[model samples]
Target: MKLRALLLGILLTSPVATYGAGGNSVVTVNPPIPAPDWTLPAIQNAKGNLSMSDFRGKITYVDFWASWCGPCRLSLPALNALNSQFADDPVQFLAISIDVVEEDAWDFLKRYSVDYPVVIDTEGDIARTFAVDGMPSGYLLDGQGRVREIHIGFKRGDELKLAESIKRLLSDLVTSEVDET
Candidate 1:
């Protein structure tokens, strides 16, 4: 209860910019912060384990979701579409399921198809590490692995705004690489 209240207050007070007229606001972190590195057992689209560092030097979008989350129903499919859109680009999408019961997550995934890698955080360790304040929380990390944007809730058409942000970040990354060259 206290955590929920604190999260609500933070969301309300955070400096979030609304994208488009959909009222979908993304919390852009000024001076992007380093994302906490993690390694988890991959459940879909791969074998063994995956680590955040393995995708370094690419735009990584870390999304925290669960089967019980209502917003995830919309977010999972939408995020999958976004993943496809950037398939040819230097971007990686990771979905972390915070379901205590592993079978629950599997059942949900059976219904909604997610093409990208999905990992299960059955013990909630990863969620606690990421400080997930809300369901379907998305962290957009730049190529350097710094979290550039944070989306707490999933609303209709939120993916469009997220796409725009990704494009802007990718552009910046490309320009920086060119400058270095």
Candidate 2:
């Protein structure tokens, strides 16, 4: 279809940075690429600005959400629970909102209180950088700052799968650290 062609054109034309042993060259992006760096203000904390690099040594679950996305209503609270579960572990959860009207997001937060840290991204630059094409997209980053998984949408049973992925990544981190030592 025309829509498919348009998307294909965009993908084929997209600029992808490539690294070489001797120098550098531009190449098409492959999967599991390094996530783009971004810094945003804390939406509900006194922590000031939070940069992606700050989570270098931790497993980061970056959830991109919006007030209008119904799945986010469920996803955020669930993420809070996951955050608590991983409280003692080296894991971090960042709920970044793309709500154009930040007041709306604030109101939603008022109704649904969460314990996890939140970042207000009204400009959506971070979401664009992540190429988030759906509501409630989640990016799982390993300790070394590589994108391990890109999850889209949310449903009733996705929680366990996410938790499993987190556990696997945590184990992988431990193994890698031991090997390095």
Candidate 3:
């Protein structure tokens, strides 16, 4: 209960910029501070290579998952949907597998056909760097490579909320750019 209250307080009190007509406001919650630079192994896609630095100047969704986890499997479709929804945008959806071996993760990807980049963290180093304690943990990073939101566990409608959050962040970035110009 105490942790929940603290989280809620942070969400409510964080700095936000309001936009849109009729005074409709969108809250822009800040991401948590990241640890010092650390390298983690990534499998890249079947045909291409991807690195964490490649997503610079774009909002990135880093999801840590495993093949055998039920919630992880459940979140796959939603993650796929999110990838499709933001297909034309600068936002990226990166699903990193924490499975013990690359074979299992590759097999699962082959069966699912997720359109986004799926990286294999065969040694679980990436998961440890992200402090992931659950199978379906997620971290949202802004264009500047700062962690925006960290989510754990799976719940219904989480994908929708995540998509909305991305949209809000994108909009905020655009608005900030306009103000600067």
Error of 1 at 2 (Å): 20
Runs of candidate 1 with Cα error greater than 4 angstroms are 1-13, 17-25
lDDT of 2 at 69: 86
Candidate 1 lDDT tens digits, 1-181: 4433443444567666554443335777776677777788988887889888988899999999999999899999999999999999999999999999888999999999799999888998767766687788888999888878778788888888889999999899889989999
Candidate 2, 35-128: lDDT as tens digits: 6678898887438998889888999988888888888878888888888999999999988889888898888889766887788888887877
Which candidate wins on TM-score? 1
Over 4 Å off, model 3: 1-31, 35-49
Sorted by TM-score (best first), the order is 1, 2, 3
Candidate number with the higher lDDT (1 or 2)? 1
lDDT of residue 3 for candidate 3: 34
Better of 1 and 3 by TM-score: 1
State each model's CA lDDT, in order: 0.83, 0.75, 0.70
Best by lDDT: 1
Q: List the residue pairs that clash in candidate 1.
A: none
RMSD of 1: 3.7
Per-model root-mean-square deviation over C-alphas: 3.7, 9.5, 7.6
